[model samples]
Target: MSVEIALTPQNPTHAGLSGRLVCFPHAGGAAERFHDWISGFAPVLDVRAVTLPGRGRLMDQSPVESWPDLIESIVTRLQPLADRPFAIFGHSFGARLAYEVTRALADDEQAPNLLIVAGPAPQMAQRDRKISGLPRPAFLAEIEAINGTPPEVLANTDLMDRMLPALRADFALLETYEADRASKHSPLPCPILAVGSDNDPQVPFHSILGWRHRTRSRFECRLFAGDHFFPFTNPDFADTLFDYVDDALNEHTKDLHRAG
Candidate 1:
């Protein structure tokens, strides 16, 4: 028997731009967390952040357990947005999910123009598991150390109680993901832009370099000055990302002119 997967659809907000950039959040992240960055991408790219189940507005829904299931759901939901010049930007767990989703789309002969894998290594070995097996206090301490969890969320016990389950569920997904050798490191036709932080403990420098083998298209890697979640801490990270996007688009234009 075949299982049907249901994905929560978010209405795309009008951005008055021709291109679309679909962003996936990190583990335990909500769609709203990316609104500011989306706004920044609005001048040149129509930014739409995926709202996955069991978080934010979809808090009541159960989180999907398996990676294949999650990727299938996302690919189905995102098919409509593939018509225009589109790109994907995913961080950490979201980066892995984005890579899987991109592969699935490519299998169907639908691939994005650009893929930005930020804050995560491509291979499973490089990924770390710190939060999955931790006790409650230890988990909270880990969150605190990351500095990504908001102050209000940390201060309010009730809010933390409500959010913890979803966070844990996401962590479970990351911890349990088994790498498929058959699907490992297939070369993509589109250019890939890798973003990493100098201080990110979860992703090693060599692991980030492994991404080069996954794509035959042009590849660029940039190391920003900050920790694991550099975009959150550094004010200039968004500007740097935008600059890369602009350069990629320009290069695409040049390629088109040459082909014409």
Candidate 2:
């Protein structure tokens, strides 16, 4: 409902830094997923993670089912933080959020300096069929097959039950988002760094490379070794992520100097 409930700083002590990295998690993920990243970029970037409803600290609230409403909420929350140089990093479902949020912010003439999208294309990632409306068992099976959920969690009925609401809502959001694919929107003005993995089953190399077309500014794609969850499992992920953030910020500085 408010920015305070949505955006959480991983390292609040490092707030007011010249740059910020706002992170969005995949479906069924909590902001804590980015906790480890704070240590790697805190010295230079104020890392903040988004906590959507029906999960994490917002567990008491119902998950947002509308894609437009979710994007509007995120863009509104991000507005105050965009006062300083900032970048947005999102994975899977969050990648879509980051792109839409960036587009909305850019419309307000307050775009981020960089947009880092991982695990999906700038547009909706292709899906075999709509699973959100499937029967409970079938839906869970489909989610398990996607490999986003851990095997142990799938085995634990209690955990799965607790996670179902948010998971269902998020999947529904994706189902509805498919309708927007044919809609026309302009490319973003800021640079974009699209990260993917060599062996990601959900997102192919071309899907990651697709982000290049979403930006009018610079675009780069980096492939690593792992699956869709590479950002959490890959050892070299932090280094590569921070490196791009640094480069983007440096480039922004150079542009500012030229304009001054």
Instruction: Provide the TM-score for each candidate, comma-separated.
Output: 0.84, 0.91
Evaluated with lDDT, which candidate comes out highest? Answer: 2
Model 2 poorest ten-residue lDDT run: 1-10
Question: What are the candidates' C-alpha RMSDs?
Answer: 3.4, 2.2
Give me the displacement of residue 250 in model 2, in angstroms: 3.0
Question: Candidate 2 on 180-251: residue-level lDDT in tens?
Answer: 462356778999899988877888888788778788898889888888788888999988888778777777
Model 2 RMSD vs true structure? 2.2
State the local distance difference test value for candidate 1: 0.73
Candidate 2 pairs with clashing backbones = none
Residue-level lDDT of model 1, residues 76-183, one tens digit each, is 878888876678888877787788889888888888889999754555443255575688899988777765466667888977877787677767776666554523
For residue 252, give model 2's deviation from the true position in Å.
Answer: 1.5
